[model samples]
Target: MDISKLKEMPYDELRVLYKQHLHSLNISKATINTASVDTFYLWRKDSKTLFWDTVLSNDFESEARSRLLKTLSEHSSGNVNALVSGYLSHLRKFRLYISSDSTWEQSETNQVKTEKNTNLRRTKKDIVIPSPTVEQVEFYLTKWDGLENYHLQEDALNKLFLELCPNNTDILDILLKASTLNDFYSTNIFSIYPVAKHIRSLNIDTRLDAGDVTLVRDIQHVTISNKKRSFYSFATKYCSHHNPLDYPIYDSYVDEVLRYFRNRDNFSDFQNDELKDYVRFKDILIDFRGFYGLGTYNLKQIDQYVWQLGKDYFPKNYGKKKRGDK
Candidate 1:
C-alpha cells in the first residue's frame, strides 16, 4: 500500500513491473484472480502523495469508493478488465521470483479466447455478443423519423452504447431505455434554466462546452468539515443532444484518465469530438483496446480493467499525464 510508488512510477516501468509480479494465470472457473490481491509493492517513502492520490490513500469515503467501483461494474466494464489484466501484467513483471515463462499478456489473451471457446461456454454463463453491423444500427436509428435533434442524439447514443456494450440483450435494453429520453430536451429548449441552456448547446463537438455546465456555489458553509450536509448544487444539462448517456459519464476513473491526458497536453477542457486531442485519445484507447480483446469482450469489463491497469501500473502517468494531442 505504498501510495507514493503507485503514484510515482511511469507506465513503461510499471508495464515491466506488471509482467514480473503476477505472472501466472490464476485459472478459476468462477473468477480470474480471486479476492483481488495487491500483489506488487509500491514504493511509498513518505506521506506526501495525497497531492494527487485519491482512493489509494483512504481520503475518498466509502460512498465514493462504492460509487467508483459500481461505475466499473455497471457503466465501465472496460475499466475493470483493464485493471485486472494490467494488474496481472504488473505482478508477472516485477515478481521475477515467480517465473520467467509467465507471459501474462498471453494469459490475458488466452482468457478471452477461453471465454469465446465453445468448450468453455458449455460450462460458463458468460455471454459474448457480436458487435452489430452499422447497417443494423442505421436501421434501428432511422426506423422512426423522430425529431431532428432526437435523431442526432439517438445516433450518437447508439454508436456510443453499441460500441461499449457487447452483450446484445444489454445493449438493446440500454438503447430502448435511452430512446425515451430523446424528448426530454425538446420541451426544455426555450427554457432559460441553466441546465436547459447547457443541454441545448451540447452536440458531439460541443460535449466539452463548459457553457452547457454550471458549477453552482450551493455549499453555503460547512466549517464543521467531513460531517456537513456538504451541499453543492450542480445542474445536469441535457444539451442540444438527446441524452447524456451517449458520452459515458466520465466516472472517477475516466475523470482520472482524462485529466492525466488533458493536463499533460495542458487542455483546460474538452467540448466535443474535436477537442484538439480527441483523435489522439481515440487512437490510444483503440490501441489499448486492440491489445486486449475489447471488440469481443464485455465493453464495461474491458473499460474497468483498462482504467485500473492505468492507475495501478502507470501511477505517475496513468491519470496525471498523457502525450498525444490532435
Candidate 2:
C-alpha cells in the first residue's frame, strides 16, 4: 500500500485496506486475530505513519509485526526460506515507502500545529458552570447523604479521624490508602509521612473554613516531591468529613464530572491548571453552587453528586468498581 494513499484515507477506509492486503497475502484468519486487527485499527486512528513504521520494523515485541510473521509462517507451510523471503518482501516495500516519503514528518508537523491552535483557544476560554434542575439537585442530595454515611465507615482512617483527633498515624494511613488505591502511578507513601505529620502538628482546625487558602498552603509546604496529588486527596477527604458543608473532595472523579457536566450543558471550559490550585478549585465549586442556586446542598453533597455523576456517565474515568465510595 502507498503510504501517502493510506495517510489520505479515513480510518474506516484504512482498516478495509489493511484487511484486503492481509487477504491478498493469503494470511489465514486463525493467525490474524482480532487483537492484531484491533491494534492496527488503533494505530491507524492514532497515526498511519506510526502504524506502517511499526509494521516494517519487524520487532518481535511489536504486536503487528509478530502477528504478520505468524500469518506468513503458517501460510508458508513450514518452508522457512519462503516465509523469510515473503516477510522481507513486505518489510522492504514498507521500509522503502517510509524512508522515501516525508509523510511521518508532515503528520507530526500538522499534529503540532493542531495542538498549538487548541492550546490558544483553551487559554482564551472561560469556564462556565451548569445549572442543575430541582429534581437533579434532590437526587444528588439523596445520593450524597447515602454515600457519605457509607464511605465514612468504609474508609478506616476516615472513620478513625471522625472519632479521634488528627493524629500522625491515622493521617499517614489515610495518605497511604489514597496514594495506593486505584493509583496508576506509584507514589512513595512513606516519604509523605513527614508532610502528613506536619499537617497534623499544624492542627489546622479542619472545622475552620472550607475554602481556607492557608490550609492548602500549609499542606503544600509539607509536600516534599511529587506527592501533592496524594496529599491533597487525603487532606480534602479529611477536611470534608470534619465539615461536610465546608470542604468538598477534589480528585480525578470530581474533576471529570465537573468537565462532563460543563460539556453536556455546553458551558464554558474550566482549566485543569485552575483545579490544581486548591483555593481556585474551592472558589469554582462555591461559584458553581451559587450559580445553580445549590446553596441548600452541602459541599459533601456536591462532591457526592459529582462522583456519582462521573461513575454513571463516565465509567472509563472511574476505573475500578466501588472506588470513589470512600
Candidate 3:
C-alpha cells in the first residue's frame, strides 16, 4: 500500500483492508486476524516509542547507529543481498511503534495506562467453555490425561494460546467439535495432526487429544517443501520426548523482528543480555499494541510480523542491486 494511504487509514478501515487483502490471498480469517493484529502492533510500536527512532538517530555514542552504518557501508558496495538484508533488519527491528532498545520513559508511559482506570480496549473475558457433547468432553479429558504433558508442558502451551488467541473460544470450540465429528482429516485436522505425528514418533503412549490433529496439520501443512528446513529447526533436539507440533511455531519473522528492533546482528545476541529485562520486553509489547490499536496480541503475532516483513522486503534484493544492477 502507498505509505500515505496506509498512514491515513483508520483502525477500522485498516481492518477492512486487511481482511480483504488476506481473503484474496485465500488466507483464513483466523490467520488474517493474527496477521492484522501484528500489523496493528507494528504500526503502533513504530509510532509511539523512540525505541526505533533512537537507533537511526545519527548521533555519536549512539551504539545502534554506529553498528547500522557500519553494516550498510560494508554491504552497500559489495553485496545486494547483504545490503538488502541489512535494510530488512532495521525495518523488522525498529518496526511501526516500538524501538530497538528500551527506555525508562517508555516504561513509565505504559505503567500509567495500567494505572487502575485505564479503559480496556477489549473486554477481558474468562475461559468460556461451550457444551459440545458429554461423551466427547469426557473422551477428550481422558485422552488429555493420557498425554505426557497433560498437566504440565501441554497445559503451559494451552495457557499461552488462551491468553493470546483473540478468537479463543471459536478455536477451542472447533477443537471440541472436531473430536466427535469423526471426519478426522476432513475437520481441517491440519493443526492438530503434527502434534499427533510427533507424539507417535516419540514412541510416547499418547492418544490424540481434542486439538491434536489440527496442531499436527498446521506444522507441516504449509511446509510443502520438505527439502527446505523449517524455521523451528532448532527444536529438533529439545523436541525429542516433547511434541514440537504441539507448540505454536514461529518462522524467521520472530528472529528478523528482534534483530531489527534490537539493531543486533541476530536474535540470539539480544537474548543473551536483554532477556534479563522483563520490564523492557513488556514495554515493547505494550508500545506495539497501542501503536497498532490491535485488540490483543502475543509473541506469535510478533513472529508473523517479522515473517511478513521478511517476505515483503526480501524480493527487492533477490535478483539485482538497486545501485549497481542490470
Q: RMSD for each model, in Å, please?
A: 20.2, 18.8, 20.8
lDDT (C-alpha, whole model) for all candidates: 0.32, 0.51, 0.34
Sort the candidates on TM-score, descending order: 2, 1, 3
Model 3 Cα shift for residue 63 (angstroms) = 19
- The clash tally of candidate 2 reads 0
Give the winner by TM-score.
2
Model 3 stretches astray by more than 4 angstroms: 1-198, 203-248, 264-295, 316-326
Backbone clashes for every candidate come to 50, 0, 37
> Candidate 1 on 1-326: residue-level lDDT in tens?
24345457664464455443322332231122221222231222112232123233343344334433443345333444333333333333333432334233347776566446534323212211111222222332343344365456557555553444322234243343233232332221122233222322332223333322222112111223233322111112222122332211222334344444333332234543322232333344444345333455333333334344333323342333221100
Q: Which numbered prediction scores highest in lDDT against the true structure?
A: 2
TM-score of each: 0.24, 0.46, 0.23
Q: Best to worst by lDDT, what's the order?
A: 2, 3, 1
Model 3, TM vs. native: 0.23
Better model by TM-score: candidate 1 vs candidate 3 = 1
